[model samples]
Target chain A: MKRIALLGMPNTGKSTLFNRISGASARVGNWPGITVDLMSAKILMGGHIAELIDLPGIYDLHGFSDDEQVVRHFLANNALDLVIILLNSAQIDRQLSLVLQIKKLNLPCVLALNMSDEAKRAGITIDAHSLEQALQMPVIEISAKYGDGLPKALQAASNILNQVQQKPSPNTIRQLLEEDNQIEHEMERLIQQHVQIPTSLSNNATDTLDKILLHKWLGLPLFFLAMFLLFQFIFTAGKPLQDGLAWALDWLRTDVLEIAFASTPAWFHGLMLDGIYNGIATVAAFVPIIVLFFLVMAIVEDSGYLSRAAFLMDALMAKMGLDGRGFVMMLMGFGCNVPALMGTRVMRSRAMRLLTMLVIPFSLCSARLQVFIFMIAALFTAQQAPLILFGLYLISFITMFMTALLFQRQYKSVEPFILELPPYRLPTAKQILLRGWLEVKHFLNRATKFIVIGVVLVWLMTNFPSNVAPASAGTYAGQVGLLFAPILDPIGINQELAIALIFGFVAKEIVVGALAVIYGMQGDALMAQMATQIDWVQAISFMLFTLIYTPCLSTIATLNSESKSSAFMWLSIAWSLGLAWLVSFVFYQSARMLGF
Target chain B: MQLLSQLESGQSGIILAIEAEESLFHRLSALGFRVGKPLSLIRRANFNGPLHVRLGSTDIVLRIADAMRIQVNTR
Candidate 1:
C-alpha cells in the first residue's frame, strides 16, 4: 500500500481534488496534536491501494499552527510514501516556498499546478517543460474544479509507485542554507523566462466586478445586500418546501402513526405517536430548507468566489486580530459551528485561533434556524417569517461583531489573513449537489441517533403519572418542570416550556422534539400558547442565549480535539455561558422596564 | 508609507516594499506578491476578510494593511 499525502497552501483546490479522487469514502479521524481530524481517502491505484491523505492547507512547515504541525510531522516522520504538492498557479511565489520545504524532505514528489484554467484566463502563461527542469521535478498543471489534466498528474504519482523508484529522501534537519534563496531565485528566473503574468486581467473583468462588489465607498453596502439576499432565499424561497415537508410529516402522524397504535396499550401508543413519530416529523421539516441553504453555500465556495468574499471583507477583520482564515471559518460557521471551529486549523496563530473559536459559538447554525422560523412563523404570517428570520440573522451578526470587539480589546496579537484568491470557476454541479446531499444525510442520521432517544424519553416522562415525580403532581413531565420553575422565572418562561428548551442543550433539535411531545395535541395552536407563556423579551432572550450558548457536546469535543487545548475548550464553554447570561439578563430586565 | 494595512479597501494603489516591514503584503510576497506592483483594496469584511486586494491578473487576500502599506495612486 502506498501512503500518499496531498499538501498545499490554502485555496489551491486541494480539498476539491481530494473530493474528486476519494468521493465521499474518506475516513475522517482526528490526529494527535491538532484540533481537526486528519482526513484520508483510499484510491485503488493498482489493485494495491494508495491512501491519499489530505492535510490542512499550510503555507510553511515552520509555523506553529495546528495544520502546519500535522504536515510537518508527516514529512519528518516519513509518514507518507510520497508527498504531492498543489500550488496555486497565479500565486506561485507564495506557494513555491512550501514546495521547496517539502523538496528539502528528499521525498519523491509531483507538482500539480492546479487551476491552470484560471491561470489561462488570468493571462498568465508558463513553460511546463522548462518549469519542470528548473524545479528538478515532475510538474503537471491542472484545474481540480474543471478536471483538467488531473489524470496525467495522478499518472505521474502512479509511475513513481510502479517503478518502485529509489526510496524518497527522509525529511531531516541538516539546515540547508540555499533552500529559500535557491527556490525564490529559480522561480523568479523561471517566471522571467517562461511564465507571462498578465498585467491587465485584474483591471478588466475582475476589477469591474470588484469595483461594484468591493467598492470602498459602496463595498459594505453591497456586501450587506448580497448577504440579505442569501438569507432571504433561505427563508422566503425555502418556505413552500418547508411547509410541504411539514405537511407530509403531519400526514405520517395522522395516517401511519395512528395505524401503528390502533390496538397498542396507552403507553406504547403514546411512545409511537408522540415519541418516535414526532421526532421524525420535526427533523423532516428542516430537510428542505437546510438542503437549500447548504447547496447555495457549497456552490459559492466551490466556484472560488468565496475568496472574493474574503477579499471584500479582509480589512475590518485585521482590526479584531482575525484574518481571511477566520472569515472562511465564519462562513462555515453559518453551516455549523463545530466544523467552522475545527476549520480554524488554517489560522496559524494560537491566540487568533482561540479567539476565532471562542467567537464562532455565537454565530447562528442552521439547526437553530428551524426553531426560530417555526416559532416566528406561528406569531405572524408566512410573509413575516422571512423578515423575522432576517432580523434574527441581523441580531446574530451584530452580536458576533460586538463580541469580537470585546475579544479584540483583551487580545495581544493575531496573525494576518494570508489567503490566495483563486480565479473564479463555475462550480461543478455534480460535486456541489452531492456535497449538499451528503451533509443533509449526515444530519438526518444524527437525528435518528439522538432525537429518537430524546423523543422517547420525553414521551415516557409525560406518560408516567405515578413515575419519578410526586404522585399528586400529575404526569412526570409537569412535576419535573415544576421543580425548576423558579430558575427560569427571570426569562419569563413557565416551568414546562422552560424545561423543554433546557433539554435543547443536549442538541438544539431536541427543543423542538420535546416541545412536540408537550404540544402535539395543539399542533398549530402550540405556537400561540407558547407565546402567551413567554413574553417578547423572554422569547428574544431565549433566541439570543441559545445562539451564544456552547455548541452541542459534539462541537465541544471537536474544540477539545482541534485546538489540542482543554483550556480553550473549557473557556469556550464558560465564556459563552457568561456572555449569554449577561446579554439575556440585560435584555429581559430592560424589556420589562419598557413595559412590553 | 510602510504599513499596507493603512490603505482603505477600494483604493486602487501601487505596491511598495513588503516583508521588510513585516506586513501582510510581505506574507503575500512570500505567497508570491512582489514589490513595485499595482495594488488595490477591494472590500473588507467586519471580521472574516483578512485583506482583499486586486493585483495583476489575480485577486489576493492577505492579513492586514498589505495593500494599505503599498504606496498607490488613487483617482
Candidate 2:
C-alpha cells in the first residue's frame, strides 16, 4: 500500500482533512496535537487502497519539541510514498516556511492549501498556480471542513506517488537543519511573489469577540459562568433523557426479562438481572450526561474559546509550574481521564506531562461526577443540590492545583508556555455532532466491558459461600467490608458502602451499581434507601471520599502506559487514596464536632 | 531598542535579535520570531503574565520572561 503522511503546522485543519478523506473519525479540536500519536487509516483512492499516516502537527522540522522529533524521526526512518504538506491558506506567509523546509527533504510531496474557505471569506487570495511554479510541487486549494477539493487532492497525491521513485534516506534531517535559514529565505521569496493580502482584509470579528471574552475582569467570571451553565444543562436538561433510559432498562429487566426467564434457575435469573442488567443500566443511565458534556465541550473547543481559556488561565497555572495548555488538558479530564491523560502528549516537556498526569485524576471526571450527583440528589434539597455540586467542582480544581504545587518542585525542569490562539470560528453542526458521537461511543465501548466485568466480580464476591444469605456477613464481600470496617468507621461508611467502594476501585461508575445490587433497589427506591441509611453529613463525607479516591482501573491503566513507570503509577494511587481517606475523615469528624 | 516585553499593548516592533539561551532561541525562531520579523504586542495578560503577540498571521502567547529575551526595535 502507498503510505502518505499528512504534515502541517498545528491547527492547520490537517486532522479534519484526514478525517474527510479517509472517513476516519479522528478527533478534530481547534488546538494543536489533537492527533498526538501517529494515526493511520486505509482509504480507497483512485481505485487503490492507500494508507494515510497523519503525523502530529509540527511548527518546524528542526524544532526540538516532541511532536517535531516524532515527525523528523518518522520521515527519516520510514519509507514514504509521498507526503501531503497542509498549509492554512489564511496564514500562508508564516506557514510557508514549513512547506519550504519539507520540500528540502526532496521527497515526492504535494502542498495542500487547507482552509481555503476561510481564506476566501477573509478576502485573502493565494495564487496556487504561481506557488506551484515557484515551489515546483502541485498546489491544491481545499476546505477540509466541507470536504471540498479532497478527491482532487488525493488524486494529485496518487499521481505523484506513481511518478516519483522512493529514495529512502536518513540523511534528510541533517541536510534540512544545515540549510535552515536558506529555507526561510526561500519561503519569504515565495510569499512575496505568489501570495497577495489585501490591506482591507481585517480580522475585526475575531478581535471584537476576543476583546470581551479575554478581557481581564470578565474573562475568569465568564469562564465560570459557561461551566456552570454546562453543568446546569447536564442535570436539568439531561434528567428526563436519563430517566427515560433508566425506565426502559428497568422495564426490560423486570417486565420483559422476568417473563421470558420465568422458568430459568434462580441463580441464573439473579446473575442476569441483579448483576448484569443492574450494573450496565446504572452506568448507562449516565450516558446522556456524558453525551451532553461532550456536545458542549466540542462546541467550546471548536469555537476556539478553549485556547482563550488557556490564555486567561495561564497566569494562575504558571504558579503551579504548569502551562496554560496543561490547564486545558485538566479541563478535558472532566470528560474522561484516559483521553485527557493521552492529551498530555501535547505537552513539550516530560516533567510537564508527568505533573499534568498526576493532577488529572483529581479533575472530577464524569463517572465521579455522576456518583456525586446521585448523592446530592438523594441527600440534599432541590435548591441546595446545584450549590453542593458546584462546591465539589471547586474542590476538585483546588485539589488539582495543590497537588501540582506540592509536586512541582520534584520536577526540576519546566517547559516555558507557548500557545497559539486560533481564530474563533462557529463549529458546524456536523462537526459538533460527530465529536459528541465519538465521545459517547468511546464511553459506551469502555463502560459496557469494564462495568459488566466489575459488576460480575462484585456479584460473585457477595454471593459466594452459597450456604450464606446473599450479601450477608458470611459472603466474601461482606467479610472484606467488615475487615475494613474499623478503618472506614471513622468516615461513617457502612459495610454496604464499604463494599460498594471496593467495587468502585474497578470503575467509579460501578459504585452506584454495586450499591443498587447489594441493597436490592433501583431508581428512586435506591435513592430513598440511601437517604435512610446515611445522613447529610455522612453523605457529604462520602462525596468527598469519592471525589478524591484513586483513579478508576482504566485511568490507572492509561497512566501506567503513558507514564511507562510502575513506580509513578503506584505513587499516584497512594497519593490519591491517602488524600481521600484523610479528607473524608477530617470532614466527618469536623461536621460532628460542629454539631451537624 | 527595547525588549519585546517592554512594548505595551498595540505597540509594533521589528525583532532585532533573540537573546535567550540556545534551546529557547531555537524554539522561538522556529515559531517565526527570527530577526527582522514584524510583530506587535496585542495584549499583556494581567498580573505580569504572558504577552499575547501577533507575528504576521500567527498569534502567540509567551511568558514575560521569554518576551524579555527577544530584543526588538520600535516601528
Candidate 3:
C-alpha cells in the first residue's frame, strides 16, 4: 500500500480533508521508536489501498515546537509515496512557505488549496491552473468542509503516487538551506502572479463582534458567563439521560442478570453483578455527559471563540507561568481530566505543558463532583449544601493556582505566546457531531482498560479469600485501609472511609458505590448510614480529600502517555496525594478548633 | 520606531525589526511578521495582556512581551 501523509499549518482544514477521505476507520498510528502518535487510516484511493497519515499541524518545518519536531522526525524516518500539502486558500501567502520546505525533501507532492469557498467569499481569487503550471505539481482547490472538489484532490494524489519515481535531489539539506533565503521571494512571486486580493476587503463582521465580545469590561464576565451556561446546560440536559442510563443498567443487573446468576454461588454472582457489571455500568452511564460536553466544546472550539477566550485569559495565565491556552485546558479538566491532559499538546513548550498537567488533576471533575454532591447532601442541610459545594469549587481553584504558583519557578516557560485568531465561521453540524463522536470513541478506547482493571482490583481486594463478608475489616482491602488509618485519623477519615478512598483512587465516582458496598446498602439507606456514621466535619474533610487526591486511573494513564515522562506523571500523582492529605488535615483540625 | 505593543488599537504600522530569539523570530515571520510587512493593532486585551494584531489578512493574538520585541513605525 502506498503511504501518503497530509501536512499543513494549524487551522488549515487538513483534518477536515483527512476525515472527508478516510471516514471513520481512522486510528492513531504509533511510529516505531517515537513517542508521538499520528492519526492515519487505510483507504482505497482510486482502487489502490493507501495509508494516509495526518501529521501534526506545524508552522515551520525548522521550528522547534514539539509538533514541528514530530513532523520532521516522521519525514526523516518514513519514505513516503506522496505528501499532500494542504494550504488554507484564504491565507496562502504565508502558508505557501511550508510547501517550499516540504518540496526541499525531494518527495513526490500534490498541493491542495483548502477553504476555497471561504477564500472566494473574502474576495480573493486564485488561478489554480497558472499556479499548477508554475509550481510543476497538481494543484486543486477544495472546500474540505463542504466536500467540494475532494474527488479531484484524491485522484491527483493517487495519480502522483502511481507516476514514476523522481531521482532524490542531491545535497537536499544544503540545497534547502540555500533556498531558505529566497523562499520568501519565491512565495511573493507566486502570489503576485496567480492570486488576487482586494486592497480593502470588507471584514467588519469580525471587528464588530470582537469589539463587543472582547470589550474591556465585558470580556471577562462574558467568558465566565459562557462557562457557567456550558456547565448548566451539560448538567440540566445530561442528568436525565444519565439517570435513565443508570436506571437501565440497574434494572439489567437486578431484573435480568440476578435471576440468571441465582443458581451460581453467591461469590460468583457478587463478582459479576457488583464487581464487573456495577463498575463498568457506572462509567458507561457517564457517556452521555461526556458526549454532550465534547459536543459543546466542539462548538466552542470550531466557532473561534476559544481563541478569544485564551486572549482574554492570557494575562492571568502568564502570571502562572502559562499562556491563555493553558487556562482553557484547565477549564476543560472540569469535564474530564483525561482529555484536558491530552489537550496539553496545545502548549509547545514542555515546561508549560507539564505545569498545566500538574494543575489539571485538581479541577474537581464531574466524577469527583458526583461523590461530593452525595456527601454534602447526606451530611449538610439543603441551604448549606450549595454553599459547601461552592466552597469546594473555590478550594479547587485555590489549590490549582497554588500548585502553579509553587511550581512556576521549576517549570518556567520561555517560548513566546503567539496564536492565530481565525475569523469566526458558523461551525457546521456535520463537523461538530463528527468531532464529538470521535472524541468519545477515543475516550472509551483509551480509558476502558485502566478503569476495568481498577474496578476489578478493588472488588478483589474487598471480596477475596471467600471467608470474610465483603468489604469487612477481615478483608484485604480493610487491612490496607487499616494501614493508613493512623495517618488518616487526624483528617477524620476512619478505616471504612479509608477503604472508600482507596476505591476513589481508581475513580472518584466509585467512592459512593464503595461506601454502599462497605455498609451493605444503597440509595436512601446508604445516605442514612453515611449521615449516622460521619459528622459534617468528617464529611467536609472527605470531600476535600476527594477533591484534591490523585486523578482517576485513566487520567494518570493519559498523563503518562501525553507527557511521555513516567517521572513527571509519578511526581504529579505524589504531589496531589500529599497535597490532599495536608489540606484535609489542616481544614479538619482548624474547623474543629474554631468551634464549628 | 516604537514597539508594536505600544501601537494604539486600530493603528497600522510597518515592521522594522524583530529583536527576539531565533526560534521566536522565525515563528513571528512564519505568521507574516517580516520586515516591511504592514500590520495593524486590532485590539488590546485587558490589563495589557495580548494584542490582537492583524498581519495581511490574518489576525494573531500575541503577548505584550512578544509584541515588545518587534519594532514597528506607525503609519
Candidate 4:
C-alpha cells in the first residue's frame, strides 16, 4: 500500500483533517503536541487502500525540539509516496517557510491551505491558483473542521502518489539546509504576492474572555473552583450508575453464580465467588466515576480552558523548575498518570521531560483517589469527608512540587517556554464523545489485564494450603503480611492492612477488594467492620501511605517505556517507597504524641 | 530601544534584536519572533511571571527573564 505523511506546524488543523479522512479518533485539542505519537490508519483514496501517517506538528524541519526530531527521523527513515504539507491560511506568511523547505526535499507534495473558512471570516483571501503557480505544486483550500474541499485535497494527493518515483538526493537536502535564510525570504515573497490580509481583524470575544479567565487575582481562584466543581460532578453524577452496577454484580454473585455452581466442590466455589467475583466487582464499581472524570476532562481540554490554567500556573510552576505545560500535564496526572506521563512528549527539553516524569507519580491518580474515598467514607463523618479528601489533594500537589525541587539541581537545562494560545471554539459533541471514548478504551485496556492478574494472585495467596482457614495467619498472604507487620507496626498497620498494601502494588483499587475479602463483608457491612477496626487517625495515616506509595504496575510499565532508562525506573520506586514510609511514620508518631 | 519586559501592557513595538542562548534563539525565531517583526505586550502575569505578547495573529507566553533579552523599539 502507498503511504502519505501529514506534515504541518503546531495547531494547523492537521490532526482534525487526519481524523476526518481516516475515521480514527485521535485527540483534537486546540493545543500543541496533542498528537505526540504517530498515528496511522488505512483509508480508501480514489478506490485504493492507502495508509495515512499523521506525524507530530512541527514549525521547521530543522528545529531541534523532540517533536521536530520525531518528524525528521520519520521522514528520513520511512518510504513515503506523497507528503501533504498543510498550511494554516490565516498564518500563511509564517507557515509557508515549512512548505518551502519541504519543496527543496524534491519529494512530490501537495499544499493544503487549511482553515480557509476561518480566514474568510477574518476577511482574508488567498489566491490558490497563484500559490500553485509559484510553488509548482497543486494547491487546494480546505476547512478540516467543516469538511470542505477535502475530496479535492485527497484526489490531488492520490494523483501525486502515482506520479512521484524517486527520493531526493542527500546533496539537495544539505544544500537547502545551508540556504535556510534564502528559503525564508522566498516564502515571505510568495506570501506577499498571493495572500491578502485584512487591515483589522477583530478579536473582541477572545480578548474579553481572556481578561476574566486570565485575571491577576481571579485566575487562580477560578481555576481551583472549576477543579472542585469537576470533582463534585464526577461523584454526584456517577453515584447512581455506580450503585446500579454494584447492585447488579452483587445479585449475580449471590443469585446467579451460587445456583449455577451449586454442585461444584467447596474449594471451587470459594475461588470463584469469594476470590475472583468479589475482587473484580469491587474494582468495577469505580469504573463509572472514572468514565465521568475523563468525559469532563475532555470537555474542559477541548474548550481551551486548560491552556488558561497552564498560563495561570506558570509562575508557580517555574519556582519548581517546570513550565506551565508541565504543570498542565501534572493536572492531567490527577486523572491518570499513564497518559499524563506520555503527555510529557510535548516538552522540548529532555531534562524537563525527565524531571516532569519523576514528579507525576505524586499526583494521586483516580485509582489511588478511589482508595482514599473508600477509606474516608468508612471512617469519617459526612462533613469531615470533603475536608479530608481536599487535604489529600493538597498534599499531592505539595509533594509533587517538593519532589521536583529536590531534584531540580540535576536538570539545569531549561528550554525557553513558548506556547501558542489558540482561539477558543465550542467543541462538537462528536469530538468530545470521541475523546471520552478513547480514554475509556485506554483505561479498560490497562485495567482488565492487570486487575485480573492482580486479583487472582491475591486470591491464591489467601486461599492456598487448602487445609488452612481462608485468609488466616497461616495462609501465604497472611504470612507475608506478618513479615511486614513489625516494620509497619509503628504506623498502626496490622497484618490485614499490610497484605492489602501488598496487593495494592498491582493496582491501588485492589486494596479495597483485599480488605473486603479479609473482613468477609461487602458494602455497608465492610465499612462498618472497618470503622470498628481502625480509628480516624490510623485511617488517615493509611490513606497517606497509599497516596504516596510506589506507582501501580501499569504506571511503572509506562514509566519504563517513556523514560527509557531502567535506572530511573528503579530510582522512582526507591524514592516513592522511602518517602511514603517516612511520612506515614512521622504522621502516626506525631499524632499519637499530641494525644490524637 | 529597550527590553521587551520594560514595555507596559497594550504597548506595541518592533523587534530590534534578541540576545539569548543559542537554543532559545532558534526557538523564538521559529515562532515568528524575528527582527523587524511588530509585536505588542498583551499582559504580564502577576508576581514577576511570564509576559504574554501577541505577534501577528498568535499569542505567546514567555518567561520575563527571556523577554528581558529581547530588544524592542516602542513607537
TM-score of chain B of each: 0.63, 0.96, 0.96, 0.97
Which candidate, 1 or 3, would have the higher lDDT against the true structure?
3
lDDT of 1 by residue, A110-179 (tens): 9999987777876579787898998878899888998889889888888776766666443332233235
lDDT (Cα atoms) of all candidates against the true structure: 0.68, 0.80, 0.84, 0.80
Off by over 4 Å in 1: A1-203, A249-254, A261-273, A276-286, A323-395, A406-415, A441-451, A454-480, A503-578, A587-596, B1-30, B34-57, B65-75
- TM-score, cand. 2: 0.61
Per-residue lDDT value at A123 in model 4:
54
Residue runs of model 3 more than 4 Å from their true location after superposition: A1-202, A521-529, A592-596
Q: Write the per-residue lDDT of candidate 2 for residues A1-596, one digit (tens) a residue.
A: 77778999999998788877777534332223233456788877656677788888999887768888677667766667788999999888778999887887787889999889889986699999998999999999988888888778878887886674755564665455547746656887897688643222236678888888888788778877876676577567777997899789978888999998789988888788877876677567656766776677677676777778778888888889887768877876776676677657656689988999999999998779879888888889999998999999998998999899999998644455777777777776666777768866765665566566766777788887778878766789889989988889999988888877877786787678777877888989999999999999889988898889875766775677778888998999999988999989998999999999
lDDT of 4 by residue, A413-493 (tens): 567777777666566566667766776576566555655565677778888778877776678988987888887988888
Best by TM-score: 3
State which docking tier applies to candidate 4: medium
Sort the candidates on DockQ, descending order: 3, 4, 2, 1
Measured over the true interface residues after superposition, the C-alpha RMSD of each candidate is 4.7, 1.2, 0.7, 0.9
Question: What lDDT does candidate 2 reach at residue A192?
Answer: 64
Q: Indicate the residue-level lDDT of A460 in model 2.
A: 80
| Global lDDT of model 4 | 0.80
Over 4 Å off, model 2: A1-202, A231-241, A255-264, A272-291, A328-354, A364-394, A410-414, A440-448, A506-540, A551-570, A588-596
TM-scores of chain A, one for each prediction: 0.52, 0.56, 0.63, 0.57
| TM-scores for candidates 1 onward, in order | 0.53, 0.61, 0.68, 0.62
